[model samples]
Target chain A: MTPRSVLVAILAGRPNAGKTSLLMHLTGSPQRPINFAGTSVERVESRVVVEGTELQVVDLPGIGSLSALTRDEQEAIGFLQNRAAQGSERTVLCVVLDAVKLSVELRLLAQLSGLGLPLLVALTKNDVARASGRPVDATELERCLGVPVLEVNALTGAGVAALRQAILRRAETGRPMPLDIDPAAVAARVQPGSAAPARSLTDRIDAVLLHPLLGLPAVGLVLLAVFQLLFTGADPLIKLIEAGQAALAAWTVQQVPAGALQSLLVDGLIKGLGAILAFVPQIVLLMTLVTVLEASGYMARAAFVLDRALSSVGLSGRSFVSLVSSFACAVPGILSTRIIDNERDRLATIAVAPLMSCSARLPVYVLLIGAFFPPRYAALVLLLLYGLGIALAALVAGVLRRTLLRGGHSALLMELPEYQRPSRRVVVGQVWTALREFLVRAGTVIFAASLVVWLLSYYPRPAHIHAHYEARRAEVVAADPTAQKAALLELDRQEQAAYLEQSYLARAGKALQPVFAPAGFDWRITVGILAAFPARELIIPTLGILYSVGEVAADSYELGSLAQPGASGEGLRARLRSAVDAQGRPVFSTLTALALMVFFALCSQCMGTLATIGRETRSLRWPIFTFTYMTALAWVCAVLVFQIGSALGLGPART
Target chain B: MSHQETTLDCLPPGAVASVVRVEGEDQIARRLGDLGFWAGTLVEVVRRAPLGDPTQYGLRGYRLALRRVEARRVVVRPGQVP
Candidate 1:
């Protein structure tokens, strides 16, 4: 089959001009984000078949003018200039103009006209403009600007079909006409009868939402609701995913004979992939809420309210959205930093975003806090850990601004767009895109890392150890037939634990144990920490495997049982509690647990976050710098916690 | 009518003004002008942020938020409240 020739349509507009909504209407569903060549600036691209001709629509990043200031704006201008340089035969520039703000938006239209590309204006928000008593006539605008104009209401799908037809037609035969024009004059000409402006719905909404006394609290409530949804609302779904994964692994084990392939499938691939898949629910929920907030125009208002507070930490209000989102996951949070215009501010926000204590760290915290602290103090310690992350993030951002990323001012010049109902199509499309990106990462980098860790812990099974275990199993089976099953299972567990103790991973952990000695981590803890590099939540399962508690989900009630003082159960938490060192002393004291939690709170343990940082910045230096600084800080803080706690006599037997 | 010339940040909420000129050649000033703070353009001080630094201004039928540092760069002639 011959490939259909595709026509190109580039959507351009200033921020908050309803360009995105218009693009959503034109491209039905599913827009893919593609970075412009050689730069990190991403533009959403979609392919649509309009009247038998396939059309490729590219939504450029919003820009104020052709004379660009920020990197993203420069990239947009560069893309247009390059397209213009190439003889514009199959390309049409669709400029989205906000009808309510015709004069300001027309300025961009006039500037774009200078490019001499075939142009069409998509006039959006015409309904709102008309309700405000200053409606713009599309035909009059077409006559005034000497280009095709279509009145479009993106919310209700008004005039979308005509716009699509115009786009295709213009791409084929439209000619570039270089006509110098004044934007204000043209706007005035088009709107011949202007009435006094009535109080807008946006004004009434803002009067309450943006009020000085009530605005901050309202913003707080909104963020708190989002946080609550991410934190606990998705818990049941995450548990369901984990349960399904465990069931699949169990079913596989029962079907396949015990061998290397079975172990690899059940223990390595399925478990590793499931650990990430479990997060899909949280990611989808976060992306959906963020999209809603952004599309409803409430995000900008939130930023405006919080700008003063964030500016004290060398970040603008824009960074608040990214940082808050980091509390769910740092990968998406870092991606969201593109909203910030200042390069230095964006970079700084990206640098410290992971310190917001993402949901993945909750399992590790819960396990440790349950195993060590009393039930009464568990909540306090958890709160302290969260607070530690935020405090350190602020400190790091401030220090970075003063030193490495110095001299760039965080300019807070942003448009506070009028509130509008978020379009369902756009929200769903964005959520789907975020989910796909996350799953791709899980399938590639995380899958590979999981296998490597599995190999390291599975290899070099000496013949002597197997022989000894086999002999022990034979004696148990021979001595008592009735109790053989129970005895054999214990022997099998011990055999696996012994084999792991002698594996290459354990050897490396032992060799590096001295490095973590100040932080009170033994070889077993070291191995868990090392294996958790791929993803932070992997530490729970890694600890489970290392301690010979068998495979266990992170949120299993067995782990939670450790919090009860008089509870009786043989879980990973209990195993960790009773674990001993060479001197017959307990391996984990309360101080040690505190130090470990502190380390994990500050450490750069998640490879996904680092990889995202590299991709977002388009440089290896920033990620490397972030990894080094965070690790060093984590180590120092861990050492301090251990030393201080020990000096205060908070030892193993105290609790 | 004679009007008092002042920086944009000086106008109280609900005060109307006409932009005299944006006073700098830097990127911030250029961006301000691009957002429709040109000479003779009417602008109104809508409100200030809760912490009282960045203020919202209405111009060209849209609202914008600018910090005091950026707003202070735009010279304006203040008029009576609408």
Candidate 2:
């Protein structure tokens, strides 16, 4: 009935010392954020009960020396100097060091030794150093620093048991060894740290990743690979879900007494809900990839690459990581601005992060890109769209920082972790969690939102109004062989979508059609976009409904296929092709696609992202501003791109 | 060069340097190494990783790691290249 004594082990280290890798190995499987009571940085903690003692080992932020420059580094030092600061109050310090680079680390150890508190040195990356012919004498090093030093191969599970025992031994001791390191010596090393050396392998990696030429393309390539994988891998699963949804709808209609209730459940709820639910697989895939990237050292490098660039936009490079968090959902991403430590930078970062084109945007982008762009240019168009998002984010961020949130933005004082191969297990777990979250959202916000949109679109359904529809349905359902046979020719035409003029979604689309006409989007796209507001992936379902989805053979092009403009130019496909500007030429050209992608990527249309901003800031001002500005930006950008591009012979020149 | 001997630059990473300066800017640094570079103290670079940066050095019966970039920022004179 008693809780085990939770021993807190705080692992402190210099950058590139493989601290996280060691912690990952120490705490196997399903690692959660180890949140300290009051701090934003989760002191990476994992608890394990031993000998009736519950011990929590935290991988603290890497600090070069007790004398650090950045705020986080200072916090790390303060935590070590005063255990109460990290909230453990009784936490033990486990000084993690790269054996290959000991002398500098010893300074830290020496400082810890003086503290008189229980301290153990985890000499990590022994495998790496030993392979590279740089091995340290652990015993001698321990003797030299007057602290227990254990060799650990963080990559492999070597020496972990020893390290654990050492930690447990300290926890059992439960007494502080007062430190006595001369503070003067620590300060003498560097004159009041202006910042940790801004030049290191960390920043050098940024030089390439942040380069405009390679940066955008590299991002595009990574995104293309990830989405292509999602598109291909999720296809089979989506089909299964689609089949089930259809079967449920059919059964529901049979159970109902062929009245308004059946229509509401089947037409309004089923179609709209199905559209939103269908994107679960893609979201899971994205979350999985993101988790792996974050666990590996590459994500840190990404932040480093974007830091200077973000700074130019009145945001910190540290904001880059928070923005990346949006790919999962906007709530956490916006909340992650806490790490920014600067109000101006955090606000600016929050506003633009939604424009990074979160994974929710993935569904809409994929659908549009597949539908409009040629099959061969599928991935390229998708890539362009993502690129457009980043570009718009930069532009918007720059303007906001300069205009609204004016003043000096905090620069990125980052720790560049060494790159490592992503752990497959961690990624799998992340994917599982993301999938669970998506499903949960489906039943909550997305589900309710779907029902509402469905209700709005389904209500006031045109029943027995149109001559062609009323005449056709009467003849087909007459139950007489001659009546059905005579109506078969018209049956195909009736099924071709004469029913949409009767459905609820159609009317809503009709009302919104003129709004998007200037952008060359027809009623179908406008309806789809509206339905997708709650969940971007639901756009496909809205399109299916608008296009009279049921009769379209699932295996064939169905309602999802890219409908190109035919020579005749009459159908929905022709409308897409005939989207012309003032000069009367194709408007949806290559440049137009790029521009649309930019608009979509940067637009603040997602309700969830805005909701998240509102929640995090505890104010509607940010979300409202974010929404208005992004929409205006998207509209202007799209119009300019289409109009200018058409003039330069890019899109359909006439509307 | 006279006042620099007691500074971090006077004691660089690789070669042993007789600390000519010892005035520390803050307590954090002093607690790590010395109260600053001590005029009589000795420092020497012991090892560096493959990247040839973030070099470790031996001094005052303990080792300290300073990135090469940080070292360049610290002016040091070689007493004896160890």
TM-score (0 to 1) of chain B for each candidate: 0.93, 0.55
Lowest summed lDDT across 10 adjacent residues in model 2 chain A is found at A190-199
Please give the lDDT score at residue B48 for candidate 1.
Answer: 96
lDDT of 1 at A298: 95
Candidate 2 lDDT for residue A346:
81
**Runs off by more than 4 Å, candidate 2:** A1-29, A32-47, A54-121, A127-150, A166-169, A174-178, A182-349, A357-384, A415-444, A460-472, A478-525, A551-601, A612-620, A639-655, B1-82
Question: What stretches of model 1 exceed 4 Å from their correct place?
Answer: A1-3, A33-42, A192-198, A441-443, A553-570, A653-655, B80-82
Query: Can you give the lDDT of residue A493 in candidate 1?
Result: 80
Q: Evaluated with lDDT, which candidate comes out highest? A: 1
What is the per-residue lDDT of model 1 for residues B4-75, given as tens digits with 9 covering 90 to 100?
799999889988888889999988887887788877778888899999979999887788899999999999
Provide fnat values for all models in the order shown.
0.62, 0.01
> Please, what is the whole-model Cα lDDT of each candidate in the order they appear?
0.83, 0.58
Candidate 2 has a TM-score of: 0.66
Task: Give the number of the best model, judged by TM-score.
Answer: 1
